[model samples]
Target: MAEWIYEDGIGEARAALIEDGVIVAAEIEADDDGIAAGTIAEGRLVKITVPGRRGLVRLDGGEEVQIEPLPRGVTEGGRLVVEIRRAALPEPGRAKLALARQASPEAGIAQGPTLIERLHASGDAVRRLMAHEADALEAAGWSELLEEARTGEVAFPGGGLRLSLTPAMTLIDVDGWLDPAALSIAGAEAAARMIVRHGIGGSIGIDLPTAGSKAARQAAAEAVDTIVPQPFERTAVNGFGFLQIVRRRLRASLPERLQGDPLGSAARALLRRAERTPGSGMRTISSHPGVIGRIADRPDWQAELARRIGAPIALRPDARLAISGGHVDAENP
Candidate 1:
């Protein structure tokens, strides 16, 4: 047997079911003739059964609610779409309230705890404190950094090479002031090390101080490989004698976190708006958090419908109002 507790919020309904000493489902709550606590039925996307009562709820992707039960005093076939949030609360408060109401109100009033008091009361407060601290530690693991490119001629500590960076590519121009010394292989090695350590990704062009002989260019290329341990299939000195570096994306780069594609979120709005129009042939393209938020908070969505249909729109949460045109693909988000 199962027990279902129904809660109606500003625009939704949420139900919680407890069974076998555990909460089976408490997130999505729906009210339909076919739903109860013990058995899963068709149209019942989510279900759970308790010792005596059963519960079921529907979800509309994110937060926008499409359908819910009529509030008390509002008869069936009523019009109104409500959104609700459901979660577990401590049971001690329910018991205390029951006992107080049963006992003499005047006598029990001073003895019983407040509703908020019961919700927060815990047998082990230390555990709750430790969990909060652990959450902070988990959040600290994520890290990121951004490096700005040099704008003008920048001097190296040894005054032998120079590097410049722009939005398109990084330019490494060498002066070779060291007595035309057979291309200091060690200096090229040091430059390569800095590039790898800085985590530079994308195209890099290296100018090797205008080497007099092909052997000097080859020596500089070999030195770069020795200093940088990156796996290379082949390092071919191009016609211009510049080393074209194609470094693999070594880490979970910064831009990956900053940019992303879009997604959908309003199944209810799509369904209702399409239903409101006649022969408009509208369909739910996608459902996303942003669309759901707009649906829940916005006072009216008929304007959105009208925009699509090129005419005035009619929207009624009341079941009596029939929908005519659009199709709603309600996702289980």
Candidate 2:
């Protein structure tokens, strides 16, 4: 049965839509993700970056975001209301500012819908998961799905895809030992699945094996249509076996989160595993120093883990371990 599995984890909320026992779509909402999309706030116009076109606004909470269509006569230092269009996106070295537009003066201040709320609003059966519930997310290949996003690798029958994120767009390069015609079709299908699974948006380019004939290219395009849902635009496969797709990007994708904050991502994953580890008494979480540092910086998360598992929690930084190579060990009190 198709359903959404939701978990309010230690540092983040997660949801996965399962169809035929496979994850077709998923989302991870970090607790620290600032002002979600659709939030309306009053802020001061701190700077007129683009004069009449755009500017920067500092919300009452002190977060600065880029606002478009700088309302007529609204100059620097002016107070105005704006609705968030998208949350800030985390990147490797820096983060993109959240996007907003002027809001009606009479609009009521509101927070955006949460991941679980969105799932319920979808009218699909949503099953809230608990720590002791057999780990339905993992059983549905959540870890493997995350690895694929982190590594940008997805394998199919005849070929595999190598996805790379760039400033302008995400690129998917297909490679394998299949024939040109067959490989293009297979690659397109795989790329489409990856796009939907990861919630990849904005611009995307897929490079498939060059088609031997125009018919082959059409077949490849048809393959993509079979998997990806509507509300997107794509170009027909060009002679160079390239296709471009554009989707509305309202928030950061899975890859952006995992790659943008490696230490935090690893730390949270370690904490989740620790919470689920079966034992009593004290539990020790051992990981790379950076990950341990990240966890240490968030004592609240550690306390929550301890509270949930009914045990004392300890952290040990091992220089020899990789960031994601953390393990939990239960010790006698």
Winning model by lDDT:
2
CA lDDT for candidate 1: 0.34
| Most accurate candidate by TM-score | 2
After superposing candidate 1, which stretches have Cα over 4 Å from the reference? Answer: 1-161, 166-168, 181-187, 238-240, 250-333
TM-score of each: 0.29, 0.97
Across 1-333, the per-residue lDDT of candidate 2 in tens digits comes to: 789999999999989999988999999999888989989998999999987798999999899999998899788899999999999998988999999999987899888788888889989999999999899889889999889988999999998999998999999999988999999998999999999999999999999999889999999999888888888999999999999999888889999899888888899889889988887889999999999999999989989998999998999999999977999998852
Instruction: Report how far residue 306 has shifted in candidate 1, in Å.
Output: 50
Question: Among all windows of ten consecutive residues in candidate 2, which has the lowest summed lDDT?
Answer: 324-333
Question: Can you write out model 1's per-residue Cα lDDT over 206-292, one digit (the tens) per residue?
Answer: 665555667777787887787665664335554455676756432211221111101111233243334332343333433344444
Model 2: residues >4 Å from true position, as ranges? none
